[model samples]
Target chain A: MTQPSEKALVPFVSVDNMMRLVHHIGLEEMLKDLADYVEEDFRRWELFDKTPRVASHSDVGVIELMPTSDGEAYGFKYVNGHPKNTAEGLQTVTAFGLLADVYTGYPVLLTEMTILTALRTAATSAMAAKYLAPKGADTMAMIGNGAQSEFQTLAMKAIIGLKTVRLYDKDPAATAKCAENLKNSGLTVVSCASPQEAIEGAHILTTCTADKQYATILSDNMVGSGVHINAIGGDCPGKTELAKGILERSDVFVEFPPQTRIEGEIQQMPEDFAVTELWQVISGIKQGRTDARQTTLFDSVGFAIEDFSALRYVRDKVAQTPFHEDLDMLADPDDPRDLFGMVQRAKP
Target chain B: MTQPSEKALVPFVSVDNMMRLVHHIGLEEMLKDLADYVEEDFRRWELFDKTPRVASHSDVGVIELMPTSDGEAYGFKYVNGHPKNTAEGLQTVTAFGLLADVYTGYPVLLTEMTILTALRTAATSAMAAKYLAPKGADTMAMIGNGAQSEFQTLAMKAIIGLKTVRLYDKDPAATAKCAENLKNSGLTVVSCASPQEAIEGAHILTTCTADKQYATILSDNMVGSGVHINAIGGDCPGKTELAKGILERSDVFVEFPPQTRIEGEIQQMPEDFAVTELWQVISGIKQGRTDARQTTLFDSVGFAIEDFSALRYVRDKVAQTPFHEDLDMLADPDDPRDLFGMVQRAKP
Candidate 1:
């Protein structure tokens, strides 16, 4: 058997390789690096081709393809959101992504993005917190402690200098698991009984629950002024986390308006409601947090470009390390037109 | 290292496996089977969720994601088209696809579709010819002798019992290569100098050229009444093969209307021009060819449902054969909520 040519193989980062890569870089440093990549992409957001994710909705859940490109490179993520998956011992959201060269139309990297999405989502939240959270904010109240809570805690500590994380979930077992995971990470992990108790003295409120419908994890009265809210879970149509009153009171910031309008907390508001594009804020074209006394919200419905950034980061990082293996994914016939000949010759 | 559990693995059919599977079933038998699957799906087309492919177009080429789903299963193909790729010793189109279980959002199969797409496209074109071509049509004139020509030739033979294939290309080397490949395949192969010579004694005229512009491969005067024209090369916007007068004279059938209006041969016709949906004809809701003198044209711009059917076929076929390997592509932790813990435990 002949070895596949280099052009026929794509670098694939598996789940174990991703785990090993994270451990190799250390979690906080990886988070910071991911945040830098996310911020950098956001800063040049206009250069990217953006479209609302193409989704196929079913009675049980929705499967989506989110694609974006920056002219030179293209990326897309195949992700699914099934809130009931955890009940069957499966992850609620499972994902994988690919990064390809636009010039050659060749995939350069294929990676398991379930873990990278967690890291990028948290890093995106923390990056927003750096711009929107109150200055000198040292504590974050994490509502709905699921798979993303620990990454959020570490990202805040790495990017925003946070020292404490207060966690709460409707399921106390989830909160306990998150707290235990963060125990040795140098943060003062506080487990709380209620969302109200979790946000008592926290300067940043992060809500990332896993419900598939409209459920207010944080009410208007529970939210205070001069704090940033990183709302991560209300990411599909008819699914929301913050109360409508909270949205009315806060200066909401979003990744992409068209997508945020359909799938974020803003989905609860009127179509004509005002919101700021986060890219504009990062580019200094618009204000993020106008004043310390104002409430700010980062309505983070995960974007394709962030996944693009995560894929880009991983593609670069893995090239410098031994965290990838080549997979023979493309069909490269010796003569491009002799595909049938190639197949015919492969007969056993 | 522990082996990945079944839930964490996706069955991957690489280029080699796809070729082996094609050989195992025999190419003509596979083409017949693929055409049957395509016909079955087209008969129940209303049950499918159809959308135009999501494409990212660049100066040189285009990358697209075509996604579709029935109520039970979902599939998507990631493909790129670069006409200049052959000049670089690469294929003009390369693809891979995934079929997932809608119930659990887990991928069931990932297969290289570069070969499969060739098979399915040929199958689709031939299947349409079975319904639209004149009864007992035994000869075909294939205008473009590229990667798709041979597959198209074999499919026409399998489905419509084509006895002779007359091939012609702008490049004689391409025509010669195609002729040499089909020499022993039980068909009378004729290599022609021009498109007019290729169509001299043919009842089915198939044009599948590779140019990206709206050049006329088949002029209006060259096509007579009662011939079934399989115009496949005019798939993208601004890339039509047949002259407009030919379309004006023929009874046109298309896969999906909105897409055909943009990318198919009908792009040259008026927006309000009449055309029948191929599904209606397959299901007997609409008439195909009413008389022997009526010219029928299948303006095929490959639809997502066709790809879905192909993916479905490969998924079922591979399960019955040992032509696939498992890829560890998903992250499955002991507890779905402890993804961070899963990473931490992998520390070296």
Candidate 2:
């Protein structure tokens, strides 16, 4: 049997390899680097191809393909959201992503994106907070401490010099788990009994509860002036995290208006309700936070460009370290047109 | 490091394993089986989620994601087409696909689809020929002999009892390579110098050329009445094989009209051009080949449902054989919300 050529093999970072890569890079440093990458992509966001994710919805959950390209490299992530999966001891969201060369359409990297998504989502939130949050913000109130809480808190610490995180979840066990996970992460972690206590003395507020319906994790009264709300959880048509009154008061900013209009907190607003594009703020085309007294909100329903940036970052990092294994995934016959001959020759 | 659980493992059929599976089943039998699967999906096409493939087109090539689902299982293929890749010793097209359980939103199978694509394409052509070709068709003229020629020839032999295949290509070396590959496939293979010579006494005509732009492989004068034309290569915008005159005379059948209108041979015709859905014909909702003197054309640009059916078929076949490996692709933490804890514990 002939060996597959170099072109036939795609570098794959398994879940175990991803964990090792994070450890090797140090989690805080990785978060910082991911934030840098996300910010860089945002600065040049006009070059990317953006679309609302293609989703196949069922009664139980939804599966989606999020694809984006930067003219040179194309990337996509296949992710599934089944909130009920947690009860069965499975990850509620599982993902894998690919990066391909736009010139050749050949995949250069394939990686487990469940961990990567968590990392990228946090990085995106932190990057947005850097542009939208009050200057020198050092504390965050993390409501809905599920799979994303620890990462979100750590990303804030990494990017914004946040020194404190007050965590709260409807389930006490979830809050306890999050607090336990962040105990050694150099942050002052506080477990709060309720959402009101979580926001006490915090400059940034993050809401990321995983529910598939219209549930308000943060009501208008729960919010105050001058705080940046990093909303991450309400990412489907009927799912939202903030009350309509809160959105009406805050200076809302979004990743892509078309997508955020369908899946973000702004879905509660009228069709013509105003919002700023984060890319415009990052590029200085528009303002982020107008004044110290006005509230700013980063309504982040994760977008494909963020995934594209994450995949590109991983591809670069994997090439620098021996953390990826080559998977024989493509059939490269000696003659490109003799695919049948190659199969025939492989017969035993 | 802890071992990933069964839920984290997705069954992966690598290129080598896929080759072994094909040889284990015998190529002709596999083609016949694939045709059966394609036919079955066509019979119930209304149940599928059909959309034209989502493509990111660059100056050099195009990368696309083709996704479809029944109510139970979901499948999608990541494929790229770069015409200049063959000059760089790369396959012009390479693909990989995944099948997930819609109920759980978990991936069940991941397989390399380049080889499977060739087989499925041939099977689809043969299946269409079975319904649209003249009765007792035993001879086929395969134009533009390339990677797909041998498979197309053998599939016809297996499904429609084709006894002979006359092959021609603009490049004689491609024709020679195709003829050499099909020598022992129990079909009388003839090498012709031109398209007119290839179709001299054939009842079925297949045109599958791989140029990225429109080029007439079969002109109008070369086509005869009462013949079934299986046009496979004109699958992208601006890339077509059959002349406009041939299409005007033939009773055109398409896999999906919306897709065919943009990417198939019918792109030359008007928007409201009369065509029959192949699925309708297969399901007996519409007629195929109403008379012996009528010219029949199957403008097959390929569809997501065909790939979905192919993935499902491979998943079932690999389940009964040992020709597959388990890939630990998903991060299955002990507690779904404790993903951060899982990563922290993996530290050395």
Candidate 3:
């Protein structure tokens, strides 16, 4: 069979190559770089074409397609959320993404976004924290330690100059796993038996529990004044970590309003509940963390633009690097209208 | 880097392998088989989860994602339509698709869909003609002889026992090329200079011109009663082939009403224009070709379910065949919550 032309080939970064990339670029440094990319895109969020993710819900799980375009390049991520997957020894969420040229409608990059989504989610959380967290914050109470716990801690450390991480999970084994993963890191790691104990002396609180229910991981009394709450776990409908009373007390910030209202912690609130758009803060159009005594909460539900930013960052980083391999993923006939002839000639 | 596990590996069929598979199972036979698959899916159309394709239109072209799901499997195709690309010696349309297991949320197959799309489009057109075309119809007039012309002709011949194809294109070179390509397909081929001459003595008239305008390719006077009109061009808004008068005189059959209303030839008609859903006819819930004197028009805009059937068919065909390669596209860790640990352990 004849080999496809160069234009027909697309660069693919596999899971192994993605891990190699993280180590090669240094996990902390990459986290910091991804944070910068996410911030840059967020700062100019108006130029993007955004839509709430298209989701297919079934009896067991939900599959979603998150797509966005920045005029020049179009990107989308195929992700699935199945909380029960962990019981079957599978990640609760697994994803991959594609970036295509808008002019020619050809794919430029395809990569495993499971690890990238993990990295970008952390980067986004840390980016939000940079603007919403209390000034000179040094410690973050990490609640519900799971797959996202380590990345969140590292991103906070890399982006916000954090000095300490206090970890807590209902499952002691999960907390042990998280603490062991970050044992050698520069930050101080403290394991606590309860959520209340983890919040001691912590200026920022990060919750990332993975349960598909409306159970509250943080009560109104558990959260104090003058601190930042980074709520990343309460993403989908029927899933939330903080009580409605906490939302009433805290000035909430969100990524996209249309999506956040449906999937974020704000789902517990009424339709008229007001929340500040996070992009306005990043763009300097709106105020963030107005006063030291005012509580602030960053409701993160994972947006398509963040994934677009990660795709753009990876596309630029993999250039002339050994981390990607080209796959013949498109058909390019010498004569544009001779596709059938091209196939007919490949007979063997 | 450590090799990914079997669960992380997704089977991928490249362009070369797709062409090889088509030839391995003769093109004509494959077309016939694809028709059966398409018809079978249409018979059970109510079970599918359908949506109008999510399209992002740019000034120069449009990129679309068509997604659908059965109870057990989910599939989507990423396709782009850039008519200007042909002038650059590139395909006007390029596509790739994915199929995933709904239960696991893990991708089962990924394949190049440009060739498969052409095959499926033709098969779908032929499948529609099986119920709508007049009995003993053997001669077809194939207008707009471009990339899809040969497949359209061959599919008609293979599915409905078409005996002769009269080809005509505004570009004589396109008609010449299509005529030469189908010369040895066991059908008598004729090259005509004008649309009038092409439709002479023909029982099926197929129009597939590629102009992104609402220009008429077939007028009311050019079409006669008792013939099947297969209009595959004029898809998308602002694109239509037959004049409104022709549609007024015929019984139109469509794949999905909401989509065809926006992208099919019926776009020229009023919002309440009467049309029959082809799936209804396939399932024996509605009538088709009630009388030989009744004019029948099959407005083909293509649907996600047809692509789903094609993806399912390809997944089954490539199972034990050497027509596919494994892609390490997913990240699976030993402990589902230990994704960070998986990446950390891969540091080398």
For each candidate, the DockQ is 0.71, 0.85, 0.86
Each prediction's TM-score against the native?
0.97, 0.98, 0.99
Q: Write the per-residue lDDT of candidate 2 for residues A1-348, one digit (tens) a residue.
A: 557899899999999999999999999899999989988999999988885688998888899999999999999999998888878777788999999999999999999999999999999999999888998799899999988999999999998899999999999999999999999888999999999999998999999998889998898898889999999998888999899999999999999999999989999999999999999999999998879878999999999999998998999898989888888899999999999899999999
Q: What is the interface RMSD of each candidate, in Å?
A: 1.3, 0.9, 0.9
Enumerate residue pairs that collide in model 2: none
Weakest lDDT window of 10 consecutive positions for candidate 3 chain B = B51-60
User: What are the per-model numbers of colliding residue pairs?
Assistant: 0, 0, 0
Model 2: per-residue lDDT, tens digit, B41-79? 999899898866889998888999999998899999999
What is each model's TM-score for chain A?
0.98, 0.98, 0.99
Predictions ranked by TM-score, top down?
3, 2, 1
What fraction of the correct interface contacts does each predicted structure contain?
A: 0.71, 0.86, 0.88
lDDT of 3 by residue, A1-348 (tens): 778999999999999999988998999999999999999999889999996788988999999999999999999999999888888877788899999999999999999999999999999999999999999999999998998999999999999999999999999999999999999999899999999999999999999998889988999899999999999999999999999999999999999999999999999999889999999999999999989998999999999999999999999998768999999999998988888889888888
Docking class of 3: high
Model 2 spans with C-alpha error above 4 angstroms = none
lDDT of each: 0.92, 0.92, 0.94
Model 2 chain A poorest ten-residue lDDT run: A83-92
TM-score of chain A, model number 3: 0.99
Top-scoring candidate (TM-score): 3
Model 1, which residues run further than 4 Å from truth? Answer: B1-3
lDDT of 1 by residue, A69-132 (tens): 9999999999998887889987778899999999888889999999999999999999999999
Query: In candidate 1 chain A, where is summed lDDT lowest over 10 consecutive residues?
Result: A1-10
